[model samples]
Target chain A: MTNQEDQFYITKILEGDSSYYTHLVNRYKNLVYSIVLRMLKNEDDAHEVAQDVFVKVYTSLASFKGDAKFSTWIYKIAYHKCLDALKKKKRNFDTVSIDATYEIGIDQVENGLGQLETAERKEIINKAILSLKEDYAAILTLYYFEELSLKEITKVVGGTLDNVKIKLYRGRKMLFGILKKQLDPETLAIYERGTK
Target chain B: MKEEQNKEMEALSKKLFKEVELQSPDSNFEFKVMEQISSLPIPGSMAKYKAPFSKWVIPITIITLIGSILLILLFGTGNQYDIMSKLPSFNFEAISSPLQRIPKTVIFAMLALAVLLFAQIPILKVTFKNRWH
Candidate 1:
């Protein structure tokens, strides 16, 4: 729904027609769930945290001053709630060394991805995304999937614009690195066939 | 060449992410959230403004105790001690005379301490209430 429509429902709910909240919840559930799922990486934890995000949004709805888009506001809430859940579980996302030797050209990787069925290609990319550090995975999802601007993402993720840019840069590199490893043999086979 | 590759990767990422479907929560997710929201106090329905026990009770008790002490010191006649003398109790003169000789500064300090102690009750009550919420 449009932001105007969101404000309408928000007004209704604030006026005690709280059942209007169901519309807001339905509107943003998938978006909020997707971000929470990407960050938490556990269905059960994601489900619980997503519910907490909506409930918090409902309780704090009056404080939403319309200074930012409703989607960005909810995303900020979801992101922080995921961080809290991670801290509670003592789950850390420390940086790890990725194998750097598996680099392949983007064109070759693209050709390999094209050759796979849609579901298979999607699975490979999703798995690679899930394998990265949580911050990188979340940044990638927000940047690419949600199409939030770097400025908007900085607001949601709470970092300087340069910091977000760095994360986005590193996140994209790590994603490509992982994708290259998974698409290596397939791209090599395609290369061989092309050479023949 | 590096910049060109970066552009290609960006385009590729955009294309791939578009195909990534969002995962949905359980069908009852909205119902569950609404259930919890229903349990919450409605906005602007201010709870009844019942005064906290410490807010009124502590001050009243402190005032009564101080008032009773003042009344005995200011209004008690010499005959008030006649009842004690009849009981053949330990000499009240020793205690009463010594109490009167005690320094005014000391009396003021003790009264100040009592006031401070009573003051903290409401402060602590407020602090704990804030922490709980």
Candidate 2:
């Protein structure tokens, strides 16, 4: 929904028609979930953190001044909630290798994207996205997956646009290396069919 | 040739991540999100009406009280004639007889209650101020 549309629901909520908030929650659910999942790997944890993200959005709705798109604002909150949860658990994002858990599936990835289900293809892409460091992964998801501009990303990641641009550049390079390393030659060829 | 190869590499990498998978939560996700939102106290509710309540109010009142007491104590010890000399005083002839008829018991009770209140109020004020901190 547009900012004006979100504002209509927020006004209704502040005026006591709090049930109108359900639309806002449903609207951003997937976006928030995707970002949270990238930040924290576990599905169960992502689900729980997504709930906190919405509740935070609902409670803090009054402070949203339409300065940024509703998507960026909510994403910012979700990003922060994930960071805070990480800190509380003393899980250092800097040191934890996100790609360490996965067995690199060279055989399957080499099979080529010949007739893979649309959903399965995305699932493979997600595995490749996970190979970067956490910050890089998040930025990659926001820029490529979420289609957020560097300005909007700066809002979510709390850094200057230059920093986000740098991350996006480096993150793209890292994803290239990781995917190249994990995918067999034939599959990589199919995935890169249109380019050059 | 070098620039061309670099461009080709960048293009190839771009194609791989171009169609990113947007991962979503389970189907009942909205309902679950609503459940949590329902449990939370509404925004601004927690901070309701909690003004700083003027920290100086108690101190200023206390200082004014002590100043008043000091002024009263200083003048109360003077001889009646010396006090009367400062202002021309005429006794209220009409209320003089009624004052004598007041019961000593009632007067002593009022005096005791006043003393207790005056003694306890400063202590109560201090305790109340500390609770805010």
Q: DockQ for all models, in order?
A: 0.30, 0.24
Tens-place lDDT digits, model 2, residues A6-95: 889888776555578888887788778887887787789889899889888888877878777888888889899988877777765432
Tell me the tens digit of each residue's lDDT in model 1 across A59-167: 7887899999998999999999998999899986544345544454676677788888899998988877877787777788888877899999999999799999878
Off by over 4 Å in 1: A93-104, A184-187, B43-133
Q: After superposition, how far is residue A78 of candidate 2 from its true place, in Å?
A: 0.8
Off by over 4 Å in 2: A92-120, A185-196, B1-20, B52-133
Overlapping backbone residue pairs in candidate 2 total 0
Fnat per model, in the order shown: 0.59, 0.53
Q: Which candidate number has the best TM-score?
A: 1
Pick the DockQ winner. Answer: 1
